[model samples]
Target: MTTLPVRPVTDVPARPQPAAPRREHRLRSLDGLRLVAALMVAVYHYAGRGGEVARAWGTSPAEQFPTLHSYAAYGCLGVQVFFVISGFVICMSGWGRSLTSFFASRASRLLPAYWAAVVLVTAVFALPVVAYEAVSPSDALLNLTMLQMPLGVDRVLGVCWTLWAEVRFYALFALCVVLPGVNRRRVILFCAGWTLAAALTRSVHEPLLDLVLMPEYAPFFIGGVGLHLLHRDRRDGYGWGIVAVSFLIGQHYAVRDLWNAADPHAFAHRTSGGIVLVVAFAFVAVGAIALGLLNGVNWRWLTTAGALTYPFYLVHEHLGWPAIQLLHRTWGLPSYATLPLTVAAMLILARLVHGWVEKPLTPRLRGVLNKAR
Candidate 1:
């Protein structure tokens, strides 16, 4: 056997090419988890809006099953979860796009669906049901901009308040995109400075300022941006300090709000301290995003649930209230029965809006805007 130069099996370890970085694949679970957050909000609304039947269902629904009530009451905080997710998604989405493209994308997503929902709500107002709220002509005009809050007008739909926050956040983030040297750090600085401004104006309530920065809610958004940085950079320690500070600030305000409002029905922290619920909610969102818990959770219905959330959220409150009132009052259905019926109706209507209105309108709007540009 010609002893070929015995190449040692462990020949000089070839310089390990730096391990190819792990690509951050799309987290489908986040999409699925969105329905989780939306469902929580729905449950919150169902219970909170039960009105007289709330007592019939049980004791103070917030106090009856304290655990269930607490979770449901805190469900309004689901919007915070939505906010953080929005910040992360927006950062990911608007990263390299030009300002016009980013704004066009937002308008295409937001405006048409909102206008359709407004029309649907206006039609519902035409019904004889006038117990919940009177139809205001001004609200109809103000709501068209989705800037009602900042402009000192009531939202046409109660839930559209969240849209106002989202619109301002889009404006804020768009400004960041245009600023040179804007990075996660710049965002944190803006958050801190913004929070400080809110603190300075704590005694004075300025709708425009609050609507613009809403620094009281900054932590949630800041924490969200932090999560995005962690995901994109694949680093744990990146921008965590601001996230921690932001979360703590959020908890402080959450507790204070419950204390000040002291609506026994809405007090989520009555059984559990507000801070604990806040922390748990934060963890649910952070854990979901960080661990990719919902990644590749590819069920068609799950996607449908996620898609339904927007229209359902928009249409559910004003519309479902009427459905629940009709069933509970006319049919004499109990709270337990009407609750499901109302939610079911919302789902059906949301499906119609998503299929006929949003899904169709979005492409046309995008095409029109793109062509105009």
Candidate 2:
């Protein structure tokens, strides 16, 4: 073989690899938003139960303060905010992962705590001292499967109705993520189309499908996912401003319904206005991403408080009515005093439950599930 001319061995430096893009830090503003939302829900429940403060506050001319009853009446809107955040974060976390692993992880994260809560509530309702109405075995089983929404059965734990909706949303989202050759644009379009169809068909008289699909709320979750994609590549301050304005507008409509001296139909129209407001809010959320406003804040205290919100949401409604009734019977306190006191107690208990129960159990359950898998 003819020897090829000897090539010189060049000392070439290896090219440096690009660093992985770091996840945007957790935004404290979102936690703050959560804290406010959870508090609003607690306050709303407390008000509905005829707590002294709620009554007094409602009667007071100060109720129109734009921040007072506005926040209180729209507390349920917090659940919508939660759906949006959940869709965003879950998609972010589970993206690029195997569908099996994702489902397993989600099940571990949610099922154990949820099951425990249901069992405890069932026990409470069944106890001789409580003498609350007992849920049927079928209903309990449905709740266990997170299928109460579609089954047309009353929820075993009333607060858990939303949880079932969340389960459905999660399942649908996972399927979209896992299926082969799925286009992201198509997934978004499908969610949007489904939501629109649900909205259009909502006037149908059948009660069963309405309860199961929860068409009224589907758009909120779908909008949230859309917002996530919009914000993924941009972080401009103007986005935050847009979110602020949308929130304000939504609050305006909510307050108008709560305090307006209009016909009930008028109130319904105003309340329905929030759907559009929330869509606007999504645009703002996208802007927030563009502005880099999503950077994580170091508010350990607020974060800690935020962590307790879920359990607080569950217990507040149950405890609030009884607490108000007891105070009314024993001390004859005014609505204002009893309301604030009851809310304070509920918040305190929520913190305790979060620290003592949910926090401790979440990690252990996750571990067990991981091992099982």
Top candidate when judged by TM-score against the true structure: 1
Writing each residue's lDDT as its tens digit, candidate 1 over 33-150 gives 6777777678777664345435334334554344565556666767877887787777667665666677778889887778989888877767664455545887787788887766
TM-score of each: 0.81, 0.70
Worst 10 residues of 1 by lDDT: 52-61
Q: Estimate the lDDT of model 1.
A: 0.69
Q: Report backbone clashes per prediction.
A: 2, 17
Model 1 spans > 4 angstroms off: 1-26, 49-71, 129-134, 178-208, 260-275, 371-373
Residue 301 in candidate 1 has what lDDT?
72
Error of 2 at 86 (Å): 2.4
lDDT of 2 by residue, 205-234 (tens): 576666545565565555555545556644
C-alpha lDDT of all candidate models, in order: 0.69, 0.58
Q: Top model by lDDT, which number?
A: 1
